[model samples]
Target: MTGAASISRLVKKSFLGAYLEDALTLFEAGSFLAVIHQPDAYALAGTAGPAAHEDLLQRFADGVIPAPHTRELAVEGVVFGWLVLDTPSHAEASALDFVARSLREIISRELLRRGLGAETLEQYREVALLQRAVGKLNGSLDVYQVAHSLLDECMATSFPADHALVLFLDDASRTYRIVQSAGSRELPYAERIAQSRLFSEVLANACWDDADGEDTLASERMVKGEIVNDLTRDPRWDVDVPEVSRMLIVPLATSRIIHGALVMASGPSSRPFGSGHLKQTTTLATVTGIAMANAHHFHQVQRILMSLIQSIATAIDSRDTLTSGHSQRVARIAHSLARAVSQDRREFPDFAFTEMELQEIFYAGLLHDVGKIGVREEVLTKATRLHPRKLELIGMRLELWGAMHQREWTDLFERLQAINSAYDVSEEDEALLYRLANKSIAIGEATIEVLSADELSEFLTPRGNLNAEEWEEIKRHPAESHRILENIPFTSHFPRILQIIVQHHERLDGSGYPAGLEGDELLLQSRILAVADVYDSLRRDRHYKKALSQEMALAILEQEGRLNKLDARVVRVLTGALESVEHAEAPEPRAFGLGSPVDHP
Candidate 1:
């Protein structure tokens, strides 16, 4: 039954029945009172009425009932039923007319109450749907992720579209492309629609050229969202997806700028899109647009920050010509090694790096040598045990000594040159240097030792060119890097960047400098960086050592692994990765950025 008819029956049974019976009592016996509903012709007979309910309905249907006092029952200009009374005199008829007016007023109030209740329920449903859309969109900061979430929301129960597509604007291209889609329809049709002039005009808030040559401002439709009930008949519908019978178009925008458009379509068998669908989709688009805007701004800031970081790394590497591009190579190698480790689950059962963690590792590798900026250039570039000027002064002193003593000291000068340039000084050479240290020379009334204490200490060095003080300064770089990075704020996003960079030089054994961190005290990211740093350092030539071949470099890394100075699993992974690339049919592996060897030695 219709709601109005049902309300009419309920009022008669609950209140009108008793009033009609009392009104009949005010008249003589055999008085009749009945209510005939308009929708179903249902009759309710009063207790004092002589006619039965079914007979009254039959009489009304047959049009054979006697004419009686009649009052129309209606509410808000909509007729529900009629109240009929048959009495003996004018007094009883007048009293029945008063009763009929009172009954009409009661029915009207009940109908109004029912209408308000339904309106309130619909409002509650709409609020709940909006809350759910906001929750889903707020879960991620990635723009693509937000787009996917938006499509999912459109296909949800509240919106119920057969197909949905989210198109985002590419600022550089000045066109829109579908980023996310749903349902069985192929993407070519939607893609064409996204790039069409209709979507462009909608997003740009410009005039749309109708198929009949009429101009319609698309922005007007976009203000509250648009619904095209029949795509075949709509003048603006150009792209043909056979299954789509109707569609809703809403712009994904905020007050500042429009980012894209959201298009939802229904198939031939599904319900057509309506004004309610347009309202819900529009609200969803607004929430998604705000999320996308925030994500875009965040990524822009991230790009700027990354550019600044790369510039700093370049400056650090440029200080010494031999170490040029060293930081970038280390970063690439470290990132590759981390990826390898993550794939080898058996070896590192508890270790796996997420994409964010891998990025942190790469950044750490780039800034690993940032502390070198604080070191003096002369000390950093030192390649010999003795300074050139010191050697020259010694040569002049020896020449003076030869002239004063009337003897040639050419053999001693030559021996000094050999000792200064040799990679390793033999016992015989050390004894010769000791004897030279004890000798003295007098020139212009000034007596000076043949080798000063500092000079003697530097010349007798057993390995590499750096002296004791210079080596100490070089070792302080990692700590200096830590101090410099400590001043910057990177803890929020890259929480472990400082930890990874400071510990890159550390070893599994306690032989590393600075903190002397060992074994479990180190992070897996730090271990990956350490292996990369050593591998690159071995492959590239420095002032003290010649560049090693790839085979030789891997062998040295393996040896370090065996000695417990590096992570054996990580070293093995790097070895396997390099070997796999070599045997494969792809182009020669350039991922590590390995360049031709330089012969510094």
Candidate 2:
């Protein structure tokens, strides 16, 4: 077959046929087309003689392709091999040279497409990581928790470092203070590294400095909104470090305000951070700033809610004169006892009140007597057996009976005297006078008995003169309180607050109401409230009796504990707390937080 027609037919049968045909159209003497195997370079298929193909493959494998070589064939962005001319220097070779250049353009396009695909995938991965970090940052309401989580996320996302310092800018101090840190578990120096004066100075300088040209990228990121990856070269970082060490400083800031900065450092022999690390660190800082802002707002809302609750408690207390300031005193006592118990867990085993649980107890104490609002004013104010009005009615009935019998008693007295003879009388007359006098006395005594029945019954009663039915109504107040509280929605923060309140009056022996929950059934907080409530009640006068001295009240509490009417552990703790309160001066009321002393008033 002639060279052109033979080649055309061969191209039609092979996979390379289409490429070869189009390539040969530009030249009379057909050029060789083949695929190159990389690394161990060799031509898979070719139209040239074996000698020429071997020479081309050797040159490609040696990393040296001759000048004026045929076009490189690429598939899927990989250099496959060359499409070479069979007859070089011929007039057609010149035309075919252009063909090689066109093939090269096609390969270049494929390489560019592959590169773009890789970049797209990398971007997607970064976005996913960023979203995950942001989620972690916004998850907590506490400032320290947000800061710790921010540092954790940064380290998790490829910013490997042996040590890190998280500083928050105190607007009042106008300086950054280290709030949290992570890593460096083994070295004692590492533990104190973040607290070191040198470290503090560096961070402080970085935070306060403006974006002057002399400032290093580390400090300027705060002002210029950039990132610093190399602490070694940054003039802003004044610390002396080993040649192998590196650091990254990212500003914790948003568009509105700058919160702080995160300083991350890798020790000697550790890998240094690069541009990609700096980008992710910057993203983490941004997320952290948002989280901090959200946390601050969250705390503000919490403070407002606390104030609202306190107001409600105060309003509830104001409903009755007898219970004035009762709720506040009970809450303070409850808080103090709880703190005492927490400090000595060994003494009070199987009872550990977490921070949230303690808060629930405090709130429960403040609202424990809220149920009294449902009680009638007369019932609440009843200070004696038989209300005064009832006693007055009894007194009026007695006076009417006395007036009606007055004439009868006078006539009897006259008849008796007539029997005794108008003046000095005989023995019989005298005896008759004595008998009539005795009869009159008996009659008067009988009448008096009849009139005093209601008064005597009430006066003889030990507690308040509420009849059985009236007392039962008073007993239902706790349940009413529970019902009222149930209507108000509570969040997960106080899961068992209502339960504690409702069950506060329940005794260990099941003698107390409303549900009569006994030992082990009642919560620790319920027992605590019960003790605090009873202690305060005894310390203050009620409608039934005068207030008991603190020592007497404590003794009664101890008696109840012995009788199984109250929690013994709670009683003991509370007694100690009361003693402490009696001796110690009143302290300033402190906001609730760990390590703060309990408020006594």
Candidate 3:
């Protein structure tokens, strides 16, 4: 045997060490090589009877045999050790190195064959990152918070790395700073300056700039082998430390542009970087880049949505100067109450929607009253307890009645004058007339304070023969809101939420208003909106009434809950969220990534 044969013998020896019985049985079963189950794992002459042996011999006549890499192939009553290794493909047998390469290739092909390619794995990883970011966002989980979490995962996965830094490219479009860091890395102000310059000069310029496109590679200011690693070095590694000098800088790029970068380094004990390793690093970078971009994008989208919502809330407040802070105040209370329920580990298992979802809910609450924009101002701003036009009509009728009373009194006074008792009769009649006028004034005054919206509209409408023509008004504000929203293209994608806005006034007991939806018939968002809207209305100063204190507003809601007006559990959430909103400030979105610093009114 030559060197090749010796190598083959060594391979076979190690193979047998792991599976002696398998090799021996295959050698023994070569006699029966026909009509065997080819893929069976445990087939050999030792396991078969005489009659099956004949079938194995018949299969041996054909050129095919057991697969080379995997055995246990059955030839009726026999198995073979690699199916005789004989090949009719004379072309393949002619090359020695070709055969070795073929074997190596087979092992590498397994993952691809199983549908787990490098790209596929990377995709799965991206999805996982997206899920985490979204969860944090929904939990009102901060964007940087999610990045820190991802860094923790990375650190936990790679133990020996003494340092790590994750930077998110915020909207300044030129700057990216330390989002999360661990170990001895002294983040340099210079690096951030350089990073900004690079982003502005390279990434920002390359992306969306007419000269650069998706194919543009991000330019690193401190290029991996030089500037950055030196600045962020571990104190223990000295110049004599040739053992600890490996650096890996991988640019995280995606379909659109260069999203970010991941820098991984190790001191001496770490293996030298190789092509395979570079590919792995690049893969991770690409994934991280896409994730950062997506997280940033998702957050901005939320803020954009919130801004629109807040604008609506602000608009509602602006309409009634007295109730300027109403909706926002409600949102604050509701969110605070919700956190109270969600923060405690004993009671809060896991908030399902996450930070972003909570924000969406908060935004929706602020916009719930936007539809009231369509309501008539006279009705909304009605003061002194009576509708303006109806009060004028009442005044005219009273004047006519007073005229009739005066005529009768004058007649009685004349009759008394004739009997010389007119003065006494006139005095009694005067008193009686004064009492009737006072009684009428008291009725109008009493009803004005407690009269509800619908009741006010009814009472003011001249009733009976004395009033004007038949009076009626459509009272469903939700449907009206839906109609109004249906016309605003800015809120197109949010149709369901718009619907919730419309139906927000609905009651679970079918006693609320408008649609009167019950139980699950109402959306969770709508349920949350109901409490927030109600709270804001109560807390904010209004045209017709005074703003109640936060505590008083909450008490009103609690009472409404017992009465089965608003959902009890939802009110509980709002009550808990009260302080969160009161002291709660929306994080300046501009600070994170928006083009400018977001200013709140």
Highest lDDT scorer? 1
Taking the tens digit of each residue's C-alpha lDDT, what string does model 3 give over 395-453?
45454444645533344323322322111224554443344334332344453222233
Clashes of each: 0, 2, 34
lDDT tens readout by residue for model 2, 481-557: 67655633345667788898888889999999988789999987888888888888898867666789988998999
In terms of TM-score, the best-performing candidate is 1
Of the candidates numbered 1 and 2, which has the greater TM-score value? 1
Tens digit of per-residue lDDT, candidate 1, span 1-601: 2225544444646456677777777666766777667545555533347754446666666765555556666667666676766555543557667776777677767666544444533443354455456557767978789899888777666565778888887899977888889875664566777644555555555235366776544555443467777767766666666667777778887545677889887776777777788778877886787677674533333233334555566666766667877988888888877877888877787878886677677778877987886689888777778988999888887787778788778999899988887778899999988987887887679888878889999998897778988888989998888876664435454788888988888899978878898999988898889998999889987876789999999999999999999999989988888754223331111111112211111
Candidate 3 lDDT score relative to the true structure: 0.46
Worst 10 residues of 1 by lDDT: 586-595
Ranking by lDDT: 1, 2, 3
- Sequence-dependent TM-score of model 1: 0.45
Better by TM-score, candidate 3 or 1: 1
What TM-score number comes out for model 2? Answer: 0.40
Error of 1 at 484 (Å): 2.0
Stretches of candidate 1 exceeding 4 Å from the true structure = 1-303, 403-408, 443-446, 491-493, 579-601
Q: Quick one: ranking by TM-score, best first? A: 1, 2, 3
